[model samples]
Target chain A: DAGVTQSPTHLIKTRGQQVTLRCSPKSGHDTVSWYQQALGQGPQFIFQYYEEEERQRGNFPDRFSGHQFPNYSSELNVNALLLGDSALYLCASKINGGYEQYFGPGTRLTVT
Target chain B: AQSVAQPEDQVNVAEGNPLTVKCTYSVSGNPYLFWYVQYPNRGLQFLLKYITGDNLVKGSYGFEAEFNKSQTSFHLKKPSALVSDSALYFCAVPRAGSYQLTFGKGTKLSVIP
Candidate 1:
């Protein structure tokens, strides 16, 4: 069985530009969540998607948004990116009612 | 709001020695805690979780954690450390009414051979 997978292992963007990262959740999983891990810090939750709708969100600003497709894949879009937005973007997926989540390799976003 | 705290910034131990990484959490009602490990340039990997029932939860790579309700602590432990065990360790808890995990600042563990 395939685990969670993410696209574009790395990216480089400039301030005010937008970037979209993709993720394919693990097989048999339905819920997808996004997180941002800044240098020397733990990951901070961005948001979660369930049933193609946002189920929960963290303290992130409106510039960060996400979507979940019917196949349980997800996309994280960051608009007007800033240097501070440069970080590792991780995707985690779990069953609708499960507690454990499987994570992907993550996309490294570099805002230069 | 649920939260987690990993007090130590870094921990170092000799290979083959027992090791412990401390963690504490705060949550309303019952607490669902978890441990995850992250290698350099890699994503976090689930280690173990304490949902309910047993306070001692065993997980992958011979790692285990003890959940203390009175102390509100969940410290990760290993019988004998290995050089390959060196990585960043994170403690987390689920937000109320949501599965989104709130993570603590990670602790870096270095097992020296």
Candidate 2:
């Protein structure tokens, strides 16, 4: 069985640019969540998607948004990126009612 | 609001020694606690979770955690440390009725051979 997978192992962007990160949920999983891990810090929740709708969001700006497709794959979009936006973006997936989540390798976003 | 705290930034233990990584949490309702480990340049890997039932929960890699309601703490412990276990450990909690996991600043474990 395939685990959670993410695209673009690494990325580089300039200020005011936009970037999109993709994630494929683990097999037999339905819920997808996104997190941002800055240098030397634990991951901070970005948002979660279930049933193609955003269920819960963290204390992030409007510039951060996400979408979940029917197949349970998800995408994270960040607009007007700033240097601070540079971090590792991780994708995790779990069953609708399950407590344990499986994580992807993550996409490294470097805003230059 | 819910939060987790990993008091120590790093822990050092010799091989074959018992290892402990401390964690404390704050939540409005019953806590859903979790532990994850991350290696260099990798995403967080699920270690274990404490939702309900037994206070002592066993998980992968011979790791376990004890949930103490009185102290609001869940510390990860392993009977014998392995050099491969040297990595970053994170404690997390989910808010009531939410899937968002609030992670504590990770604690790095170093096991010397």
Tell me the docking grade of candidate 1. high
lDDT of 2 by residue, B4-113 (tens): 99999999999999999999999987889999999998888999999899999999999999999999999999999999999999999986677778899999999999
Model 1 C-alpha lDDT per residue in residues B40-77, reported as the tens digit of each score: 88888999999899999999999999999999999999
With candidate 2 superimposed using the best TM-score fit, by how many Å does residue B30's alpha carbon deviate from the native?
2.1
* Per-candidate interface DockQ score: 0.81, 0.78
Native interface contact recovery, all models: 0.69, 0.69
| Runs off by more than 4 Å, candidate 2 | none
lDDT digits (tens) for residues A8-111 of candidate 2: 99999999999999999999999999999998899998999999999889899999999999999999999999999999999999999777889999999998
Give per-model TM-scores: 0.98, 0.97
